[model samples]
Target: MNQVIHTLLNHRSIRKFTDRKLSQEQIHTIVKSAQQASTSSNVMAYSIIGVTDQNLKNELYKVSGHTHVKNNAHMLLFCGDLHRINRLANTEDNQQTIDNNLESTEQLIVATIDAALAAQNAAIAAESMGLGICYIGSLRNDIKRVNELLELPGHVIPLFGLVIGYPDHNPEIKPRLPIDSIYHENKYKPFAEQEQFIEAYDNEMRSYYGNRSSNTKLDTWTDQMIRKFSTPTRMDVTPFVKSKNLNKR
Candidate 1:
């Protein structure tokens, strides 16, 4: 395979990073690469916040409770931001119409998807430059505090944070479900039909967890999923999103 595909396949979430920070030129390149990602109708309804201030980073670390937040050389918050375009696109003649459209659930989905696409591009760019990266989705654990810390206005919510820096240690790639289990030919494949594949994948994952270098455990993919979903997580997200005047419809 080509270099791009090779990079994509070898992707691993790097939590341990070195002290070396990314240069301004590298930051600019990564952000520019993110901007080139596809957006719905060219709305480009997203914003990237580079957390440079040490105090701000500290605040985020407190909020996220993830040691990697402060450990990384750089942190970036990718936001689903409709506020920028909403302000610019609104005129006295179209004020009500613009507000109505921006508040819809569809727009929220669009902005979230746009931000996610851009973030993936940024991740690939950083990886290509021989840097380590980790996504901090736990930022959403306290989205309101994060908003206050970031000084984010209404209609713009941080979807996730990305921490990037030089790798301190190389990690083994996590095993993924087999292609036959995930890819459907034409119609939707039911879970009942894929039970055998799931069982095989569970064995594969059990072996992976038992053999990994750090924090090794004897576990299956199904057990992990059960633990993850058994507890309701981030239940405050809906209320917070509504408070931002998004997804109200």
Candidate 2:
């Protein structure tokens, strides 16, 4: 197998971390690798903020349900930002502003995809260097608080946060969806075989969860499904996204 491919395939999310601090050289190299990911239109509509403050990390960790994040070496908050460009183009530069401002869904999509690609690149780079990473999607849980904390300007929004550090424990590589379930040959397909795959997956997850947990409680995937979708945890996103004074798509 290709070395890079093998490394990617063996990838797993790591939660535990050592107290070892990352060197400045390591941070620079990792971020440089991230900057190498492909970007649409070369707009590079994203920005990364490295957070080192313990109190801020703690607040964000609580919001994200990842307590260990505060203890990790540090965090990288990646944002989908069009504000910088908009301000530039709309100002003395005599540049053409993105039509409809940052409110255009296309601009937002590009920013989001760009940020995600960059983040994945960073993650791979870190993994190759024997470092651990876990993405904090919960940053969306309280976007307002996150915006206030990050001091993000209009037309800019955080896509997610990345917690990186040296590994303190080895976590198992979780199985993924079958290729058939996600890959369509020519065109898009609806949820026809979704139930079947989900059934098998639920069983598999239940078994996997049992092995990982002490036999104290039945950790079924169904329970997870119920718990996650049953609550409206992230509905504040739409309104929050609108707070950027973006054009409505």
Candidate 3:
């Protein structure tokens, strides 16, 4: 495989970081790489806020409930932004035209996808530079608080945070589902041996967790999934999204 594909396949979420800080030039290049990612219809409906302030990082750490946000060399909040587009539309056309297309589920989905793609590009670039990165989805635990802290405007939502830094610890690459289970042929095919596949994967994860150097837990992938989904998570997100005038259609 080429170096790019090799880097992509060797991805891991890094939670521990060293004391080293990324230079401004590195940060600029990484963001430039993110901007180079493909966007749906070239709308590029996303924005990134790079946070290096310790106080702000502390506040965001609490909001995220993840210490990595504060510990990392840099934290980037990727946002889905329809506000810019709305303003541009208003300037070009009229308020009525903007209003007609502002609160759409399709627009929300597109912006979110755009943000995700951009963040992934950033992550890949960081990894290629021999840096580590972690995605902080827990920032969505309290979306309203994040919105307020960041002083977000309407039609903009903080999708997730990306923490980048030098690695303090090396982590095992987590296994993924078998190729056959994920990649379908001409038509979508349901797993014929679902139980068998799951059992094998669960056993593999059980070993993985048990043998891990830190926070070793006696659990399997299925066990974790059951525990996680058994309870409602981030229920406030729906109301928060509506408050931003998104996903309303």
- RMSD (Cα, Å) for all candidates, in order, is 1.1, 2.3, 1.5
Candidate 1 runs further than 4 Å off: none
Off by over 4 Å in 3: 91-94, 191-193
lDDT of 2 at 159: 80
Weakest lDDT window of 10 consecutive positions for candidate 2: 90-99
lDDT of 1 by residue, 1-249 (tens): 999999899999999998898899999999999999999999999999999988888889998898889888888899999998778864776877888888899999999999999999999999999998999999998999998888889899989999999999988999888888899989989989888899999999999989999999989999999999999999999999988888988
Clashes of each: 0, 1, 0
Report the CA-based lDDT of candidate 2 relative to the real structure: 0.82
Give the alpha-carbon lDDT of every model: 0.92, 0.82, 0.89
Error of 3 at 198 (Å): 2.0
By TM-score, rank the candidates, best first. 1, 3, 2
lDDT of 2 by residue, 19-98 (tens): 99999998898899989999998988899999989999988977787777687986899999887777666554354345
